[model samples]
Target: MSNSVKTINPATGKVIREFETISDQQLQDKIEKTHEAFLDWKQRSFDERGALIRKVGDLLVENQDRLSKLITEEMGKPINQAPGELQLCQGICHYSADNAASFLADEERDLPGGRALVSHQPIGVIFGIQPWNFPFYQVIRYTIANLMAGNTVLLKHAPNVWGCAEALEDIFREAGMPENVFNVLYIQEDQASQVTEHKRVRGVTFTGSAATGRKIAAAAGEHLKKTVLELGSNDAFLVLEDADIDKAVDACVTGRINNNGQTCVAAKRFVVVDAVYEQFRDAYLAKMKQVEFGDPSDENTQLGPIAREDLRDNLHAQVKESIEKGATCLTGGEVPDREGYFYPVTVLENVTPGMPAYDGELFGPVASLIRAKDEADAIRIANDSVYGLGGGIFSEDEKRAERLARDHFDTGMVSINGYYIAQPNLPFGGVKDSGYGREHGGFGMREFVNSKSLMIAQ
Candidate 1:
């Protein structure tokens, strides 16, 4: 494979930096160094690692704006959202630092033969394959938790966000972290599999498309290595007959258009009861139209360009195909002839299955509105998909809302009267093709380690 890493600006499609990619020998060296560091680092007290992670959090706050700007330049996330992402990263670091020690504390277990205990141990060097959509938070969510649990990390980040990857490495170094505690390998597409197959890489943690996740999982499985996969989602937003139209519309707008509608948990399918279908559609489209799209660096910009031109083109094609297939364009669907990778926030009513927008993950500012007859129909429509990452329900009837949110089929998370929020205290993941394995909270921290059982006789 070619040993060249080209950093492209998604907003303008310009090459910002061309980095010399790490050669196969260099990757092997990094794995060896990380493995060596893990031996000593894993033996250190949890308090030591926790203290360093806390320091890293402090560094994040000190440089939040600078880092946020870097993300905007690299991936075109709205300036407002960029700072929030930085803050989220800082919060995760702090949370991991404060709670990982207790989470990893050995637990006494009762067994038939003798007294036993379950202990968490570092699994050596972890290989993290993160995406560019959430350049900083995605990496931090995996890196902070893994490192806090006594494991070192080797990151192979997406090509578009190479600068963000290097910035993360610099943050650790600036926080006085030892070399090899966190190593960012500048990788070419062809070298990804080889890096994951390295002997020193004990496990893999990946966040990307389902196709890529399958390949990584297969590689890890072949080596008998542990892996955590966080894949894509075609989340549903079900609005019941009793739901408040005003609230439902507001929440749907935020859920669909946040990050220019590039989020995995963003509501892609809108299933509304026929009783208030028109009311909800009108309100939702009004709010979507009000969203301001401009340069990500603009503080007032609520929606920015889709991260890449290819994504924008794919989204445009999906919207066009949906319209051609009898879906009504309730609001924005056409791309303005602009310099940046910008597509208008699009809303489609009467979007049925078999259309491109209905069948696939629309990773842009596009939403589909489908009307259901009753509660049962709504539930059925929401679950009529292969991707089941998350879903949302809005209703005035509290009991009905709870039942729908809790009993939804195939979703990892469900929200009532609100959008999906991935907190450090919660277990975040998905089921079905949305991918398996959880991240965040205790589940996330433990993903990089092994739970070893020890038995002792009296």
Candidate 2:
């Protein structure tokens, strides 16, 4: 096996840096140190931890420009959008730091024979297996919560975003956080699997595809360890008959292309009511075609190259397979003759059940248009999927849309008529094949903790 990992600049398809993967002994030492740190960390008051976490957030803001440029260089994120990711991370850190004490406070409950106090106690080290899509945010999303909960964390980030991982560790150190509290392990998959079975690793949290999530969950389960998996989704964006066509089109376009359409909850499948199918399709296609795919460093570039050459190739393969299966390529289906791993914004109509565009996530700047007979049919179509991380219902009637999202949408989250990547105060996670457990909105602070009940006889 190779002893190192290389990070390539997706925008130029050139190698940026190569990092040496740590040996088994080094990995063990890091894990042991982290567990040692957790012992003292869990004893600290919430205020103490929060103060340090807040400092980390400040550091993120202070270094946003430099870090944002690194993200663009490593993963091909558009220059305009990269800063937004860092801002979200900053928000996550401060949000968790602010609310963790209240969220995890001991609760009093009345019992017939005794009074009960339910306390959330910190577990040991948590192992995080994160992806490259939102390198900084993905790590912060879980790390901050775990840190606030008094548990040290070990991150096995995607190879492509290892640079971001190291930078985050540096930030935490600069913030005066404990040396072993936030560790970035530079190891391969087999080593990661071994770490899952390590005696020190108390829990595991992963974000990636459903297939990989299943494997991780199974591995963690065999050891009787807790696991939180936030897997992929081909989220359906419903366009009801009463939807505001212009607004829905614009939102869907942004949703499908944001993060270059590699997002788990991005608007992948467009289930539009047949009443306004032609109108939405025409307008969406025109706007998608206008999106510029070029250098990620360019301010005017609306889209950027796919994160890796293999990812770009896989996305193109899915497009071709969907087209072969009778899905009509409406626009931007061909790969451009560019130097980087660039794929044009694509739209596919007549996307039926059997096609890749309909069944699987296209994980790129691609959209699938599925027509429905009416509002009921649109809802039905949206729910016809094994993965239900999130979905959107666009309707002019705000109350009706909220009602549909609340009672009818079979997903973990829903957007009434707009696109939102994530919010600091909202619980973010999905259901069904999209994985289980929740993050953010204070739920993440408890995922790796022990909820113990203390009873006192009256």
Candidate 3:
């Protein structure tokens, strides 16, 4: 395997920088150092760990602009969205710093003879395998929670965003954190299994494709180590017959085009009731076409290039195959003649279950519109996917919408009359093939730690 780390700018398809990859011995040393740090770090009081995490939050805020720019240049995210992602990173850090002590506090119970207590303890060194999309936010989501719980981190970032990975290490150092408390491994893909299987790495946290997540989970299981997998999603946007057509159309446009429609939780499937299907489709198509696509650095540009060229090609192929297989393209279907990896914001109508785009997650600026006969049909279509990550219900009647959200949508999270977005205070994860384990809120902090139940002899 090659030991070279090349940074390519996806926006322009140019080489930004190339660095020497870390050797096997260097990776082994990193594991050793992280283990050593965990020994002493876990003994520290919760307040101490919280203080360190708070410092991390402060550092993120101080260097948001620089970090955001690096992210934009590395992966072609919208410039405006880059700062927002940085703010999200800061918010997660602050959330963990402020609440981890309380979240992880020992719970004392009354026993027949004596008192029993349940404690949340750190699971030693945590291995984080983060993806390129939302690079900083994804890493911080796992790191802050685990570090606040008194565990050190070993981060194996996506190959495309190596600069951002290095910058993160610098931020931790600037915050006065111990050197070994957080380490970044510059290993090639071939070495991922070896690094994840290290004995000291007690738990694994991964956010990526289902295929890769399964492989990682299997490796972690082989070593008897716990793992948390946050895989892909084909989230649905359901519009009821009694819904406000304008509001539903607006939400669908934003949900499908945001982040160039590369988000795991982006609304890939749109299930709309027949009563309002025609109006909603027309409005949604117009809005999607009006979105300006250009350089992400331009403030007026609503959509930016896809993260990578391969992703753009894959999305284009899916769109072509869907159209060839009988799905009608309502808005876009071709690549734009632009400098970057740009593809037109696509909208497909009459999408059936067997179509290529309908069967798989459309990880681009393409929206699949599937008409439903009624509430039951809408629910049936929404729940027909292998992914059960997130979904949104649009309806005029709040009570009815809440009922559908509770009973019909087969997802981990549901939004009534709103677009799907995760907050730090709420639990986020999925069921079925979307992967297991939760992130954010109290559940996120506990995912990287061990819950020890104590019993007393009567």
Q: Clashes per prediction?
A: 0, 0, 0
Of candidate 2, the 10-residue stretch with the lowest lDDT total is 330-339
lDDT of each: 0.86, 0.92, 0.87
Per-residue accuracy of model 2 over 100-206 as CA lDDT, tens digit each: 99999999999889899999999899999999999999999999999999999999999999999999999999999988999999998789988899999999999
Q: Give per-residue CA lDDT, model 1, range 1-117, as digits (tens).
A: 556777766667778887888778887888899999999998988788888888888888789889988888888888888877877877888888888888999999998868999
Tens digits of per-residue lDDT for model 3, 302-383: 8888888888889899889999999999887888876778888888998997886788888888999999999999999899
Name the runs in model 3 displaced over 4 angstroms: none
Q: Any runs in candidate 2 off by more than 4 Å, and if so which?
A: none
Candidate 1, residue 201: the lDDT equals 86
Task: List the candidate 1 regions with Cα displacement exceeding 4 Å.
Answer: none
Error of 3 at 54 (Å): 1.5
The residue pairs that clash in candidate 2, if any, are none
TM-score per candidate, chains pooled: 0.97, 0.99, 0.97
Query: Which one wins by lDDT: 2 or 3?
Result: 2
Using TM-score as the measure, which candidate wins? 2
